[model samples]
Target: MTSTESSSRPYGAFPVRIGFQVQPQHAEYGQIRRAVAAAEEAGVDIVFNWDHFYPLSGEPEGLHFECWTMLGAWAEATERVEIGALVSCNSYRNPELLADMARTVDHISNGRLILGIGSGWFEKDYQEYGYEFGTAGGRLDILAEALPRIEQRLSKLNPQPTRNIPVLIGGGGEKKTLKLVAKHATIWHGFGDAETVAHKHAVLDQHCADVGRDPGEIERSVAVSDSPEKVGQGLLDVGTRLFTVSASGPDYDLGLLREWISWRDEQNK
Candidate 1:
Protein backbone atom coordinates (compact mmCIF):
# COMPACT_ATOMS: atom_id res chain seq x y z
CA MET A 1 0.00 0.00 0.00
CA THR A 2 1.14 3.47 -0.79
CA SER A 3 1.40 6.31 1.74
CA THR A 4 -1.82 7.87 0.47
CA GLU A 5 -3.77 4.65 0.86
CA SER A 6 -4.46 5.35 4.56
CA SER A 7 -5.04 9.05 4.37
CA SER A 8 -8.13 10.69 5.90
CA ARG A 9 -8.75 12.65 2.72
CA PRO A 10 -10.48 9.56 1.42
CA TYR A 11 -11.93 8.26 4.70
CA GLY A 12 -13.06 11.53 6.28
CA ALA A 13 -11.36 12.19 9.64
CA PHE A 14 -8.95 9.64 11.09
CA PRO A 15 -8.22 10.64 14.64
CA VAL A 16 -4.55 10.42 15.52
CA ARG A 17 -3.84 8.18 18.50
CA ILE A 18 -0.84 9.00 20.68
CA GLY A 19 0.32 6.16 22.89
CA PHE A 20 3.00 6.17 25.59
CA GLN A 21 4.63 2.92 26.64
CA VAL A 22 5.35 3.51 30.31
CA GLN A 23 8.23 1.10 30.82
CA PRO A 24 7.91 -0.50 34.27
CA GLN A 25 11.44 -1.83 34.41
CA HIS A 26 13.20 0.98 36.19
CA ALA A 27 10.55 3.34 37.60
CA GLU A 28 8.77 3.19 40.97
CA TYR A 29 5.00 2.64 41.09
CA GLY A 30 4.49 6.16 42.41
CA GLN A 31 6.51 7.65 39.57
CA ILE A 32 4.56 5.57 37.07
CA ARG A 33 1.29 6.81 38.54
CA ARG A 34 2.43 10.42 38.37
CA ALA A 35 3.67 10.00 34.80
CA VAL A 36 0.39 8.40 33.79
CA ALA A 37 -1.47 11.23 35.46
CA ALA A 38 0.61 13.74 33.57
CA ALA A 39 0.06 11.98 30.24
CA GLU A 40 -3.67 11.76 30.91
CA GLU A 41 -3.66 15.46 31.73
CA ALA A 42 -1.71 16.12 28.54
CA GLY A 43 -4.50 14.46 26.54
CA VAL A 44 -2.72 11.33 25.40
CA ASP A 45 -5.01 8.89 23.60
CA ILE A 46 -3.49 5.78 25.21
CA VAL A 47 -1.26 4.87 28.15
CA PHE A 48 0.60 1.54 27.88
CA ASN A 49 2.82 -0.56 30.14
CA TRP A 50 4.98 -3.41 28.89
CA ASP A 51 4.41 -7.01 29.97
CA HIS A 52 7.83 -8.08 31.15
CA PHE A 53 9.47 -9.39 34.32
CA TYR A 54 12.90 -7.89 33.69
CA PRO A 55 14.21 -4.77 32.00
CA LEU A 56 14.47 -5.14 28.23
CA SER A 57 17.18 -2.49 28.03
CA GLY A 58 19.75 -0.80 30.24
CA GLU A 59 20.64 -2.77 33.39
CA PRO A 60 19.00 -6.19 33.08
CA GLU A 61 18.81 -6.53 36.88
CA GLY A 62 17.30 -3.06 37.34
CA LEU A 63 14.02 -2.50 39.17
CA HIS A 64 11.11 -4.13 37.38
CA PHE A 65 7.41 -4.98 37.85
CA GLU A 66 4.82 -7.42 36.59
CA CYS A 67 2.40 -6.50 33.75
CA TRP A 68 -1.19 -7.33 34.71
CA THR A 69 -0.86 -6.11 38.30
CA MET A 70 0.38 -2.72 37.12
CA LEU A 71 -2.43 -2.57 34.52
CA GLY A 72 -4.97 -3.29 37.27
CA ALA A 73 -3.58 -0.37 39.26
CA TRP A 74 -3.57 1.82 36.13
CA ALA A 75 -7.20 0.90 35.52
CA GLU A 76 -8.10 2.43 38.90
CA ALA A 77 -5.72 5.39 38.74
CA THR A 78 -6.27 6.86 35.28
CA GLU A 79 -9.62 8.43 34.48
CA ARG A 80 -9.64 8.59 30.67
CA VAL A 81 -6.64 7.22 28.80
CA GLU A 82 -7.04 3.66 27.47
CA ILE A 83 -4.73 1.22 29.27
CA GLY A 84 -3.06 -2.10 28.40
CA ALA A 85 0.29 -3.79 27.86
CA LEU A 86 2.04 -2.42 24.79
CA VAL A 87 1.87 -6.02 23.70
CA SER A 88 1.00 -8.81 26.14
CA CYS A 89 2.92 -12.08 25.82
CA ASN A 90 0.38 -14.70 24.77
CA SER A 91 2.48 -17.51 26.23
CA TYR A 92 2.26 -16.22 29.80
CA ARG A 93 -1.47 -16.92 30.17
CA ASN A 94 -4.01 -19.24 28.61
CA PRO A 95 -6.05 -17.60 25.85
CA GLU A 96 -9.41 -18.15 27.58
CA LEU A 97 -8.08 -16.92 30.92
CA LEU A 98 -6.45 -13.92 29.25
CA ALA A 99 -9.76 -13.02 27.61
CA ASP A 100 -11.48 -13.09 31.00
CA MET A 101 -8.76 -10.99 32.60
CA ALA A 102 -9.02 -8.47 29.79
CA ARG A 103 -12.81 -8.40 30.17
CA THR A 104 -12.57 -7.75 33.91
CA VAL A 105 -10.09 -4.95 33.36
CA ASP A 106 -12.28 -3.53 30.60
CA HIS A 107 -15.13 -3.14 33.06
CA ILE A 108 -12.79 -1.73 35.69
CA SER A 109 -11.65 0.96 33.24
CA ASN A 110 -15.28 1.66 32.35
CA GLY A 111 -14.77 0.13 28.93
CA ARG A 112 -11.39 1.71 28.28
CA LEU A 113 -9.14 -1.24 27.52
CA ILE A 114 -7.06 -2.31 24.54
CA LEU A 115 -6.02 -5.97 24.54
CA GLY A 116 -2.57 -5.41 23.03
CA ILE A 117 -0.95 -8.78 22.49
CA GLY A 118 1.88 -10.51 20.66
CA SER A 119 3.54 -13.90 20.33
CA GLY A 120 5.97 -14.40 23.23
CA TRP A 121 9.55 -13.40 22.35
CA PHE A 122 11.59 -12.77 25.49
CA GLU A 123 13.25 -16.06 26.47
CA LYS A 124 13.96 -14.94 30.01
CA ASP A 125 10.28 -14.41 30.81
CA TYR A 126 9.48 -17.99 29.90
CA GLN A 127 12.45 -19.68 31.62
CA GLU A 128 12.16 -17.69 34.86
CA TYR A 129 8.41 -18.22 35.08
CA GLY A 130 8.78 -21.99 34.40
CA TYR A 131 7.27 -21.69 30.92
CA GLU A 132 9.00 -23.64 28.18
CA PHE A 133 10.98 -21.25 26.02
CA GLY A 134 10.03 -22.60 22.67
CA THR A 135 11.57 -21.66 19.32
CA ALA A 136 10.36 -18.47 17.58
CA GLY A 137 8.46 -20.40 14.92
CA GLY A 138 6.86 -22.58 17.59
CA ARG A 139 5.75 -19.55 19.60
CA LEU A 140 4.31 -17.85 16.52
CA ASP A 141 2.51 -21.07 15.66
CA ILE A 142 1.06 -21.07 19.17
CA LEU A 143 -0.09 -17.47 18.78
CA ALA A 144 -1.71 -18.18 15.42
CA GLU A 145 -3.58 -21.13 16.91
CA ALA A 146 -4.59 -19.31 20.11
CA LEU A 147 -5.94 -16.03 18.62
CA PRO A 148 -9.15 -17.50 17.21
CA ARG A 149 -9.70 -19.43 20.43
CA ILE A 150 -9.33 -16.19 22.33
CA GLU A 151 -11.93 -14.51 20.12
CA GLN A 152 -14.32 -17.43 20.59
CA ARG A 153 -13.81 -17.40 24.35
CA LEU A 154 -14.54 -13.68 24.45
CA SER A 155 -17.88 -14.35 22.78
CA LYS A 156 -18.78 -17.18 25.17
CA LEU A 157 -17.71 -15.37 28.34
CA ASN A 158 -20.65 -14.36 30.53
CA PRO A 159 -21.57 -10.67 30.58
CA GLN A 160 -18.99 -10.18 27.75
CA PRO A 161 -16.51 -7.33 27.44
CA THR A 162 -17.93 -3.90 28.30
CA ARG A 163 -17.06 -2.90 24.76
CA ASN A 164 -15.62 -4.52 21.64
CA ILE A 165 -12.16 -4.87 23.17
CA PRO A 166 -9.70 -3.69 20.52
CA VAL A 167 -7.06 -6.39 19.93
CA LEU A 168 -3.65 -4.85 19.12
CA ILE A 169 -1.05 -7.27 17.75
CA GLY A 170 2.62 -6.31 17.46
CA GLY A 171 5.26 -7.74 15.08
CA GLY A 172 6.19 -7.29 11.43
CA GLY A 173 6.97 -10.77 10.13
CA GLU A 174 5.28 -10.82 6.72
CA LYS A 175 4.22 -14.42 6.19
CA LYS A 176 2.50 -15.59 9.39
CA THR A 177 2.40 -12.43 11.51
CA LEU A 178 0.86 -10.09 8.92
CA LYS A 179 -1.58 -12.80 7.93
CA LEU A 180 -2.60 -13.15 11.57
CA VAL A 181 -3.04 -9.40 11.78
CA ALA A 182 -5.25 -9.50 8.72
CA LYS A 183 -7.37 -12.22 10.28
CA HIS A 184 -7.54 -11.17 13.92
CA ALA A 185 -6.11 -7.79 14.91
CA THR A 186 -8.00 -4.55 15.32
CA ILE A 187 -4.64 -2.78 15.40
CA TRP A 188 -1.28 -3.77 13.92
CA HIS A 189 1.79 -2.56 15.83
CA GLY A 190 4.63 -2.51 13.31
CA PHE A 191 8.28 -1.59 13.73
CA GLY A 192 10.96 -0.12 11.39
CA ASP A 193 11.37 2.99 9.23
CA ALA A 194 8.68 4.49 7.02
CA GLU A 195 9.75 2.58 3.90
CA THR A 196 9.86 -0.70 5.80
CA VAL A 197 6.52 -0.04 7.52
CA ALA A 198 4.99 0.84 4.17
CA HIS A 199 6.26 -2.37 2.59
CA LYS A 200 4.92 -4.49 5.45
CA HIS A 201 1.61 -2.67 5.22
CA ALA A 202 1.41 -3.54 1.54
CA VAL A 203 2.02 -7.16 2.44
CA LEU A 204 -0.70 -6.93 5.08
CA ASP A 205 -3.06 -5.46 2.49
CA GLN A 206 -2.44 -8.44 0.24
CA HIS A 207 -3.04 -10.75 3.16
CA CYS A 208 -6.31 -8.98 3.91
CA ALA A 209 -7.33 -9.28 0.30
CA ASP A 210 -6.62 -12.97 0.34
CA VAL A 211 -8.67 -13.39 3.51
CA GLY A 212 -11.52 -11.19 2.12
CA ARG A 213 -11.06 -8.65 4.93
CA ASP A 214 -10.92 -4.91 4.28
CA PRO A 215 -7.35 -3.71 4.67
CA GLY A 216 -8.45 -0.41 6.17
CA GLU A 217 -10.22 -2.11 9.05
CA ILE A 218 -6.97 -2.75 10.88
CA GLU A 219 -5.43 0.40 12.34
CA ARG A 220 -1.69 0.69 11.73
CA SER A 221 0.44 1.65 14.73
CA VAL A 222 4.19 2.12 15.15
CA ALA A 223 6.79 2.76 17.83
CA VAL A 224 8.46 6.00 16.86
CA SER A 225 11.60 7.52 18.28
CA ASP A 226 11.46 10.78 20.28
CA SER A 227 11.61 12.82 17.06
CA PRO A 228 8.10 13.16 15.64
CA GLU A 229 8.97 15.66 12.93
CA LYS A 230 11.53 13.31 11.49
CA VAL A 231 9.03 10.56 10.61
CA GLY A 232 5.52 11.58 11.66
CA GLN A 233 4.13 12.74 8.30
CA GLY A 234 5.67 9.80 6.44
CA LEU A 235 4.08 7.29 8.80
CA LEU A 236 0.75 9.10 8.72
CA ASP A 237 0.84 9.11 4.97
CA VAL A 238 1.28 5.33 5.05
CA GLY A 239 -1.86 4.53 7.13
CA THR A 240 -0.19 4.52 10.52
CA ARG A 241 -2.65 6.55 12.57
CA LEU A 242 -1.50 5.29 15.96
CA PHE A 243 2.03 6.27 17.10
CA THR A 244 3.65 5.17 20.35
CA VAL A 245 6.81 6.39 22.07
CA SER A 246 8.45 4.19 24.70
CA ALA A 247 10.00 5.55 27.90
CA SER A 248 11.83 3.54 30.56
CA GLY A 249 11.45 4.04 34.31
CA PRO A 250 13.28 5.64 37.29
CA ASP A 251 12.84 8.94 35.45
CA TYR A 252 9.68 8.66 33.43
CA ASP A 253 10.05 11.25 30.71
CA LEU A 254 6.77 13.09 30.18
CA GLY A 255 8.39 15.76 27.99
CA LEU A 256 8.42 13.76 24.73
CA LEU A 257 4.91 12.47 25.42
CA ARG A 258 3.57 15.99 25.75
CA GLU A 259 5.04 16.96 22.42
CA TRP A 260 3.49 13.97 20.65
CA ILE A 261 0.12 14.66 22.28
CA SER A 262 0.30 18.21 21.05
CA TRP A 263 1.16 16.97 17.58
CA ARG A 264 -1.82 14.64 17.62
CA ASP A 265 -4.14 17.46 18.54
CA GLU A 266 -2.73 19.62 15.80
CA GLN A 267 -3.10 16.92 13.18
CA ASN A 268 -6.64 16.11 14.21
CA LYS A 269 -7.67 19.72 14.30
Candidate 2:
Protein backbone atom coordinates (compact mmCIF):
# COMPACT_ATOMS: atom_id res chain seq x y z
CA MET A 1 0.00 0.00 0.00
CA THR A 2 1.12 3.55 -0.64
CA SER A 3 2.05 5.89 2.22
CA THR A 4 -1.10 7.92 1.64
CA GLU A 5 -3.33 5.08 2.66
CA SER A 6 -3.97 5.13 6.42
CA SER A 7 -3.30 1.46 6.99
CA SER A 8 -3.78 1.12 10.78
CA ARG A 9 -5.71 2.93 13.47
CA PRO A 10 -4.18 5.42 15.91
CA TYR A 11 -1.74 3.86 18.34
CA GLY A 12 -2.84 3.23 21.92
CA ALA A 13 -1.43 5.03 25.03
CA PHE A 14 1.96 6.69 24.84
CA PRO A 15 3.80 3.45 25.50
CA VAL A 16 7.18 3.89 27.11
CA ARG A 17 8.87 0.97 25.34
CA ILE A 18 12.50 0.39 26.44
CA GLY A 19 14.24 -2.06 24.13
CA PHE A 20 17.67 -3.62 24.70
CA GLN A 21 19.70 -5.11 21.85
CA VAL A 22 21.28 -7.98 23.79
CA GLN A 23 24.13 -8.49 21.32
CA PRO A 24 24.43 -12.22 20.78
CA GLN A 25 27.72 -12.17 18.90
CA HIS A 26 29.90 -11.95 21.99
CA ALA A 27 28.14 -13.69 24.85
CA GLU A 28 27.47 -17.24 26.02
CA TYR A 29 23.95 -18.67 25.77
CA GLY A 30 23.66 -18.82 29.55
CA GLN A 31 24.87 -15.23 29.95
CA ILE A 32 22.40 -14.08 27.29
CA ARG A 33 19.62 -15.92 29.07
CA ARG A 34 20.51 -14.27 32.36
CA ALA A 35 20.54 -10.83 30.78
CA VAL A 36 17.12 -11.43 29.24
CA ALA A 37 15.81 -12.53 32.61
CA ALA A 38 17.25 -9.46 34.27
CA ALA A 39 15.69 -7.10 31.75
CA GLU A 40 12.30 -8.75 32.15
CA GLU A 41 12.43 -8.61 35.94
CA ALA A 42 13.52 -4.98 35.79
CA GLY A 43 10.39 -4.23 33.72
CA VAL A 44 11.82 -3.42 30.32
CA ASP A 45 9.11 -3.22 27.67
CA ILE A 46 10.81 -5.18 24.88
CA VAL A 47 13.89 -7.36 24.49
CA PHE A 48 15.93 -7.36 21.25
CA ASN A 49 18.90 -9.10 19.68
CA TRP A 50 20.69 -8.24 16.45
CA ASP A 51 20.88 -10.34 13.27
CA HIS A 52 24.60 -10.84 12.68
CA PHE A 53 27.11 -13.65 12.38
CA TYR A 54 30.06 -11.84 14.01
CA PRO A 55 30.50 -9.32 16.77
CA LEU A 56 29.71 -5.76 15.68
CA SER A 57 31.98 -4.32 18.32
CA GLY A 58 35.20 -5.37 20.14
CA GLU A 59 36.85 -8.57 18.82
CA PRO A 60 35.06 -9.87 15.75
CA GLU A 61 35.94 -13.47 16.52
CA GLY A 62 34.68 -13.46 20.08
CA LEU A 63 31.81 -15.70 21.18
CA HIS A 64 28.85 -15.12 18.85
CA PHE A 65 25.41 -16.61 18.16
CA GLU A 66 22.68 -16.67 15.51
CA CYS A 67 19.45 -14.61 15.53
CA TRP A 68 16.23 -16.56 14.88
CA THR A 69 17.33 -19.59 16.85
CA MET A 70 17.97 -17.43 19.91
CA LEU A 71 14.62 -15.74 19.32
CA GLY A 72 12.87 -19.11 19.50
CA ALA A 73 14.55 -19.78 22.83
CA TRP A 74 13.77 -16.25 24.04
CA ALA A 75 10.10 -16.77 23.14
CA GLU A 76 10.00 -19.66 25.59
CA ALA A 77 12.27 -18.09 28.21
CA THR A 78 10.68 -14.71 28.84
CA GLU A 79 7.11 -14.73 30.09
CA ARG A 80 6.25 -11.02 30.22
CA VAL A 81 8.29 -8.79 27.89
CA GLU A 82 7.90 -8.73 24.08
CA ILE A 83 10.79 -10.28 22.14
CA GLY A 84 12.41 -10.10 18.67
CA ALA A 85 15.59 -9.17 16.87
CA LEU A 86 16.33 -5.45 16.86
CA VAL A 87 16.01 -5.74 13.12
CA SER A 88 16.01 -8.97 11.13
CA CYS A 89 17.79 -8.86 7.78
CA ASN A 90 15.22 -9.03 5.03
CA SER A 91 17.70 -10.64 2.64
CA TYR A 92 18.66 -13.42 5.06
CA ARG A 93 15.52 -15.50 4.45
CA ASN A 94 12.61 -15.73 2.00
CA PRO A 95 9.85 -13.29 3.04
CA GLU A 96 6.95 -15.75 3.14
CA LEU A 97 9.01 -18.19 5.14
CA LEU A 98 10.02 -15.41 7.50
CA ALA A 99 6.36 -14.60 8.07
CA ASP A 100 5.63 -18.17 9.08
CA MET A 101 8.60 -18.16 11.42
CA ALA A 102 7.34 -14.97 13.03
CA ARG A 103 3.90 -16.53 13.41
CA THR A 104 5.40 -19.53 15.13
CA VAL A 105 7.29 -17.27 17.52
CA ASP A 106 4.11 -15.30 18.14
CA HIS A 107 2.41 -18.42 19.42
CA ILE A 108 5.48 -19.34 21.40
CA SER A 109 5.37 -15.96 23.14
CA ASN A 110 1.64 -16.13 23.57
CA GLY A 111 1.14 -13.06 21.36
CA ARG A 112 4.09 -10.92 22.48
CA LEU A 113 6.18 -10.75 19.32
CA ILE A 114 7.47 -7.75 17.44
CA LEU A 115 8.74 -8.53 13.94
CA GLY A 116 11.52 -5.94 13.69
CA ILE A 117 13.24 -5.83 10.31
CA GLY A 118 15.48 -3.87 7.99
CA SER A 119 17.11 -4.13 4.55
CA GLY A 120 20.16 -6.31 5.06
CA TRP A 121 23.53 -4.80 5.94
CA PHE A 122 26.83 -6.22 7.29
CA GLU A 123 29.08 -7.48 4.50
CA LYS A 124 30.54 -10.26 6.63
CA ASP A 125 27.13 -11.82 7.22
CA TYR A 126 26.58 -11.96 3.46
CA GLN A 127 30.02 -13.27 2.49
CA GLU A 128 30.06 -15.98 5.14
CA TYR A 129 26.52 -17.08 4.44
CA GLY A 130 27.30 -17.48 0.71
CA TYR A 131 24.72 -14.85 -0.15
CA GLU A 132 25.53 -12.05 -2.58
CA PHE A 133 26.33 -8.80 -0.76
CA GLY A 134 24.69 -6.54 -3.31
CA THR A 135 24.98 -2.76 -3.47
CA ALA A 136 23.07 -0.65 -0.90
CA GLY A 137 20.51 0.51 -3.42
CA GLY A 138 20.08 -3.05 -4.64
CA ARG A 139 19.49 -4.31 -1.07
CA LEU A 140 16.91 -1.62 -0.41
CA ASP A 141 15.25 -2.55 -3.67
CA ILE A 142 15.10 -6.14 -2.53
CA LEU A 143 13.54 -5.06 0.79
CA ALA A 144 10.99 -2.99 -1.10
CA GLU A 145 9.96 -6.12 -2.97
CA ALA A 146 10.05 -8.42 0.03
CA LEU A 147 7.92 -6.51 2.59
CA PRO A 148 4.68 -6.90 0.69
CA ARG A 149 5.26 -10.59 0.12
CA ILE A 150 5.85 -11.03 3.83
CA GLU A 151 2.63 -9.18 4.68
CA GLN A 152 0.65 -11.20 2.18
CA ARG A 153 1.98 -14.45 3.61
CA LEU A 154 0.90 -13.37 7.10
CA SER A 155 -2.73 -13.31 5.96
CA LYS A 156 -2.54 -16.74 4.36
CA LEU A 157 -0.95 -18.46 7.37
CA ASN A 158 -3.26 -21.07 8.94
CA PRO A 159 -3.23 -20.21 12.64
CA GLN A 160 -2.57 -16.50 12.14
CA PRO A 161 -0.95 -14.35 14.85
CA THR A 162 -2.44 -14.56 18.35
CA ARG A 163 -2.33 -10.78 18.49
CA ASN A 164 -1.66 -8.45 15.57
CA ILE A 165 2.09 -8.87 15.20
CA PRO A 166 3.54 -5.36 15.38
CA VAL A 167 5.84 -4.75 12.40
CA LEU A 168 8.86 -2.52 13.21
CA ILE A 169 11.22 -1.21 10.50
CA GLY A 170 14.58 0.29 11.52
CA GLY A 171 16.44 2.69 9.21
CA GLY A 172 16.77 6.39 8.48
CA GLY A 173 17.30 6.58 4.71
CA GLU A 174 15.05 9.46 3.72
CA LYS A 175 14.00 8.57 0.21
CA LYS A 176 12.98 4.93 0.08
CA THR A 177 13.32 3.81 3.71
CA LEU A 178 11.14 6.54 5.20
CA LYS A 179 8.62 5.95 2.42
CA LEU A 180 8.47 2.28 3.38
CA VAL A 181 7.95 3.26 7.02
CA ALA A 182 5.12 5.52 6.00
CA LYS A 183 3.49 2.66 4.18
CA HIS A 184 3.99 -0.35 6.45
CA ALA A 185 5.53 0.06 9.92
CA THR A 186 3.51 0.17 13.10
CA ILE A 187 6.70 1.42 14.78
CA TRP A 188 9.77 3.08 13.23
CA HIS A 189 13.11 2.72 15.10
CA GLY A 190 15.62 5.34 13.99
CA PHE A 191 19.11 6.44 15.08
CA GLY A 192 20.75 9.88 15.45
CA ASP A 193 20.75 12.96 17.64
CA ALA A 194 17.53 14.78 18.53
CA GLU A 195 17.99 17.27 15.69
CA THR A 196 18.55 14.55 13.11
CA VAL A 197 15.57 12.63 14.50
CA ALA A 198 13.39 15.74 14.32
CA HIS A 199 14.30 16.35 10.69
CA LYS A 200 13.59 12.76 9.78
CA HIS A 201 10.30 12.90 11.65
CA ALA A 202 9.36 15.85 9.46
CA VAL A 203 10.41 13.97 6.37
CA LEU A 204 8.33 11.00 7.50
CA ASP A 205 5.40 13.34 7.93
CA GLN A 206 5.84 14.51 4.38
CA HIS A 207 5.91 10.90 3.25
CA CYS A 208 2.70 10.40 5.17
CA ALA A 209 1.24 13.38 3.35
CA ASP A 210 2.44 12.01 0.03
CA VAL A 211 0.83 8.67 0.83
CA GLY A 212 -2.32 10.30 2.35
CA ARG A 213 -1.65 8.58 5.69
CA ASP A 214 -1.88 10.30 9.05
CA PRO A 215 1.66 10.74 10.31
CA GLY A 216 0.60 10.21 13.92
CA GLU A 217 -0.59 6.72 13.06
CA ILE A 218 3.06 5.60 12.95
CA GLU A 219 4.77 5.48 16.38
CA ARG A 220 8.18 7.23 16.36
CA SER A 221 11.02 5.37 18.13
CA VAL A 222 14.75 5.94 18.64
CA ALA A 223 17.88 4.76 20.44
CA VAL A 224 18.80 7.45 22.90
CA SER A 225 21.50 8.25 25.46
CA ASP A 226 21.48 5.68 28.24
CA SER A 227 20.70 8.38 30.78
CA PRO A 228 16.99 9.04 30.53
CA GLU A 229 16.94 11.77 33.18
CA LYS A 230 19.04 13.86 30.81
CA VAL A 231 17.02 13.36 27.62
CA GLY A 232 13.74 11.83 28.69
CA GLN A 233 11.50 14.90 28.74
CA GLY A 234 13.03 16.28 25.58
CA LEU A 235 12.53 13.04 23.68
CA LEU A 236 9.01 12.69 24.99
CA ASP A 237 8.21 16.18 23.72
CA VAL A 238 9.25 15.21 20.20
CA GLY A 239 6.69 12.39 19.74
CA THR A 240 9.08 9.51 20.42
CA ARG A 241 7.02 6.99 22.32
CA LEU A 242 9.56 4.16 22.11
CA PHE A 243 13.17 4.55 23.33
CA THR A 244 15.79 1.82 22.88
CA VAL A 245 19.30 1.63 24.34
CA SER A 246 21.78 -0.88 22.87
CA ALA A 247 24.14 -2.91 25.07
CA SER A 248 26.63 -5.56 24.01
CA GLY A 249 28.55 -8.24 25.85
CA PRO A 250 30.65 -9.48 27.82
CA ASP A 251 28.99 -7.37 30.52
CA TYR A 252 25.40 -6.41 29.82
CA ASP A 253 25.03 -3.24 31.91
CA LEU A 254 21.51 -2.67 33.11
CA GLY A 255 22.25 0.55 35.03
CA LEU A 256 20.90 2.76 32.27
CA LEU A 257 18.02 0.38 31.74
CA ARG A 258 17.03 0.71 35.36
CA GLU A 259 17.18 4.50 35.16
CA TRP A 260 15.00 4.55 32.07
CA ILE A 261 12.47 2.20 33.60
CA SER A 262 12.25 4.49 36.63
CA TRP A 263 11.80 7.46 34.34
CA ARG A 264 9.06 5.60 32.53
CA ASP A 265 7.32 5.04 35.82
CA GLU A 266 7.70 8.69 36.77
CA GLN A 267 6.29 9.75 33.40
CA ASN A 268 3.22 7.61 33.92
CA LYS A 269 2.81 8.91 37.45
Provide the lDDT at 45 for model 1. Answer: 89
Residue pairs whose backbone atoms clash in candidate 1: 1-202, 3-237, 26-250, 27-250
Angstrom error at residue 109, model 2: 0.4
Assess every candidate by TM-score.
0.95, 0.94
Which residue window of length 10 is worst by lDDT in model 2?
1-10
36-85 per-residue lDDT for model 1 (tens digits): 89888888889999888999999988889899988888899989999999
The ten-residue window of minimal lDDT in model 1 covers 4-13
The model with the greatest lDDT is 1
lDDT of 2 by residue, 1-269 (tens): 12122123243245667887788857788999999999999999999998888888789778999899999999999999999888999989999999999999999999988999999889998998898998988999999999999999999999988977898999999999999999988889998766677788889989999999887778888997649877776666566778887778878889888888888888766
Clash totals in order: 4, 4
Alpha-carbon lDDT, every model: 0.87, 0.85
